[model samples]
Target: MRLIHLKLAARNVRRQPHRTIALGGAVAFSALVMTLISGFVNGMDSAIQDNVTLYSGGHVLVSGYTVSWSGRLQSRFADEAVANIVQSAYPEIRTASPISQTRATVVFGSREVQLSLRGVDWGKDELYHSSLILSKGDWKSLAAPRTMLMSAQTAARFGLSTGDAVLVRLSTASGQQNVTDYTVAAIYDDGAAGGMSTAFVAFSDLTADLNMKEHEQQAIAIFLKNSTSAENAAQTITKALSEKGYTVSRGAAPTSGALSASSESFVSSVVGSGAAGTAATGTTTGTAAGSSGAGASRRAAAGTVTYYVSTVQELAGEISSALGSIRWIGYAVFALMLIVSATGISNSYRMVLLERTKEIGMLRCIGYKKKDVFSSFIAEGILLAGGAALVGVILGLPVGFGIGLVPFNPHGDFGTALVQGHLKFVPSIGQLALILVFVTIVAVAAVFLPAKKAADVVPVEALRKTA
Candidate 1:
């Protein structure tokens, strides 16, 4: 009975080619919009993951707070004893790398610029390589003493190349500045890091330059073998560290100086120096300059260390959260399109039922039951929606395939003219299934009232109406 209704519904749809085409076109258009939006959201999410993984490693970062410097600089780890205790408590730990970061000014000849210097174990921090694009030289050379990697923009600004010598000056806790000469061994260009103003030096070199004692590291980047063990590991590690009288903080912890100078520069670019000063001072009142100065000094006095640890899933979550607005907009647009499509289907089906009212009444008068009539109308809706969805799926393929050719700016800002070399589009089969199910459900729901109304029509009244 169902097969017969389906066949009859399909034949009925085919008989009115224009109506079928219009309905099918609507479905195809909606599906195409949905596919594009989903693809874009997925692409954006993937992009954020790539950036974060490239920039901050997977999801978790662990660090300590210092009283003396900005938030980024404050990363104090529990002594080796605490590290051991934490490791023992969390056996799921796969890899860990100690990291230290500082900001300093590098001068080459007449050129001078401030740079954020990150010190890390080159071998352990291999995950960050994808985010680090080297135009000249290599990361291996960073192991050499008095050698540093400069950002491409920094390199350009200083007119320095690989093997070029530069003087680096850093501020210490004692308010004295320490200067050292280093050779630029490599050039890295990643817009995510704000281009070439950033530099990376060896952990040993930074430690030696700062004259630090002990193998103390400010942060530890941990990667677990199984991401599911992350929360457990974090709990165990936090417990172990707490037992050792050390405070464990997550990546999202609030602290002063969390904003980098580059971030400040970006803000300054957007909102003038007054805005920058307000941000730096944390108040619009320029009156309390002295208090602000004192607060800055006090913040500088609190020397803290930061640790970051993230699972792959956590990293993905962070990315999703960051791109939440875009995803919401995409979903909203999809919903509107779906609503429009559903309405179109409902209206089209209602018109068809109205036009065939006499035929429906005549059939009812003969042998067809009202239940059969309702079922037949529902079958027609399902057939129309299914046909449209099928056509939509067919149309979506070429559109998805063509998205790769669409130009994209991998970097969020539109200032640069460089085209993204690679465009990625990955559509999940699960997501597609969900969309199809949603469309079918909406179509079925839309037809229900129309079907019921058609079944309620009196045989005498319907017989008076035209086909």
Candidate 2:
């Protein structure tokens, strides 16, 4: 009986070619809009996320607060405690590198610029190589403390390529200034580090230059077996360190401009409910392997605070917020399209039903019941919506495919162009399914009342009026 009704419904719909085209077109357009917008937003989120995770830092970063000497601000961290905590408690760590983090000024002849400087344990700098696009020189030379790496933009700005000497001046931990010359060993095209405004050196070189001990560091970039394990792993590692008689500092959520935050920055982003609310920019390219556990070990010292921990997701809070805002924008566009399509479908279906009143009444007078007529019209709507959604999805897939094919390389302008909202488009199957299901429900529901009204017409009255 259902199959017969469906056949009759399809035949009846075929009698109104113009109405079918108009109504189906409305649904198709709505589906198309939702598909593309959602695709673009999700894609951007992925790109920005990969930009940060694969290059800017690791899945989790451990650090302490920034201190100031005169007007120079610097961020500091101690590595031994963090390494010991991870090695002893969490076997999940794939690779970890200690950093000597600071902000400094670079001079090329008379040219000077402020930069975020990091001295990395080259043996375990997993993220650096993953995000690296070295246009000149080799990474091996950076094994020396006097050797440094710069961005292509910085190299161009200073008119210095690989092997060029650039003067660096830094504010020491003791409220004094220190100056040194670093030979540029390589220049990268990595955009996630904000181009040339961020640079790297050998960890020993930074410690020696700043007159610091080897057991200390500014931060530690830790790659884990799973990025999702960051919060739990952070807590477990914290507990292990505490058991060793180390006191951990607390922190608030990071300001948009800050790096791996201090102890006061921990509550909202690192170890608690704050992470529950975050809109995770999905993971990609997984954590890379590195030489795990190579740094100096710290004694189980009492009365000392180990570093604070923040995930790459927290480090990318601002970008995630920006990506979320774009999603809202996409939602707005999709809502607008839905409204327009619903109004068009409703009004057009009403007009078509008005023309079909006599046909409906005649069918009612025969063996067909009102519910039968209603079901037939509903089946027609289902088929129409299904057909329209298929067309829209077909149209949308190519667009998504084309956008995905475009590579992400935000080098020359430090991804400024991308930051301005030009981002990659990822073809997410889940998003596509969501759009199709939503559009289908709306399209089929829009004509329900109109079909019921047409089916309810009095058979005698409709025939008499037509006669």
Candidate 3:
């Protein structure tokens, strides 16, 4: 608190340049590592979020499921009505894309690849139109019926060019194999953003091929103006849908296509199919006509749908888990680095305490209190750590930016999917400030015992030893 003690602490710190540098180096190194790790994690999270929003789904996803008595999960839904309700009710929603997809094999001459065939509404889907970068052909050509778009990777593997006709083979809702011919309209590059290569076709064309009626889709993805509000938005939407006589799932659906029983019933039937169809699918006559289970089956046959709502966090189940694991590992490394820095501070202050015993005796004889000595020592530790951490953070900004300058192939491997064709380092100012404060606290704590011992020195004993 006094200028005299601060002046003495500063002079003492300067007297041992080598020791100060050694201790400061440990603190600086820890701070540098913390900044880099935080930057890398933030960059990766941003990249994954962008990819998921543009390519896979929006921040919030609404999927419809129909479960049969045999427990087969079917991707059949008439989601246009629900999509309209959500869009009209929530001003935060930016876009709601009604999408339908099926597993299909595309054959061009002798070469063939099995990929997901996604039905996209070209007239209303704005996310893909703005986000996808095409390598060949025109995006507007997708408006034509019987035309499809494949990724550049798929096109290259198939040895096919734009305007070529490919036969797509897929199973219908009734489990019958069906074939359709589609001309390649465009090829977009995904940069291997971590998903199966999916081909896109006109919504009407794909739905017609799959025998789905008007305004029918498997899911509706709700994009938000801000991605951070997704959890709250999902909760609000779930409540609204439930109040409107819709059956909503209590939790996130399994991302792996393994859905549990609906909220009301275990036995259900396919939409547009009567109880006779349920019986044909192996449900007993009693099960289809008797109890609550039978009533649920009849309701399902009468077009009742179960909605599964999830946020992008839940949709990216495994990827989110992996990031969480990486974060914990980062924390472990950060703790170890702090411990090393703390040890350096402790050892350096102990030497200072031994060397300054006579100086402390002189100060005590001049009316300095024990608290003054402790305060001076703590201030020195803080200055050492605070200055070092500030320098470390200042140095990390350029280091991270320079690392991001070196480019890598985004489409070559799984590792590249975590970035956007290059390394990204998004250094946060708040994170740097927190690191500085934490390092200073650790340094002061580490020097506590040494400072206490220095303060306990008796004036007579110290002067006698020196004499």
Number of the candidate with higher lDDT, 1 or 2: 2
Tell me the tens digit of each residue's lDDT in model 2 across 241-269.
55654434433223312222242233222
lDDT of 1 at 274: 32
* Backbone N/Cα/C clashes per model: 34, 10, 0
The global C-alpha lDDT for each of the candidates, from Candidate 1 onward, is 0.63, 0.66, 0.75
- After superposition, candidate 1 runs with Cα above 4 Å error: 66-74, 89-92, 129-133, 173-176, 189-197, 225-233, 243-245, 251-322, 405-407, 414-423
Worst 10 residues of 3 by lDDT: 277-286
Q: Which stretches of candidate 2 lie over 4 Å from their true place?
A: 12-14, 54-56, 65-79, 191-197, 242-245, 249-306, 404-422
Off by over 4 Å in 3: 67-72, 192-196, 250-302, 409-417
- Model 1 C-alpha lDDT per residue in residues 223-333, reported as the tens digit of each score: 666445666777667666555544344434333345454533332342233321222112221111223443331122122232233444464564466457766887788
TM-score pick, better of 1 and 3: 3
Q: Write the per-residue lDDT of candidate 3 for residues 256-314, one digit (tens) a residue.
A: 23334452244243223343322212222222353454334332432335677888766
Cα deviation of 355, candidate 2, in Å: 1.1
Cα distance off (Å), candidate 3, residue 143: 2.2
RMSD for all candidates, in order, please: 8.8, 10.2, 5.0
TM-score, one value per model: 0.77, 0.80, 0.87
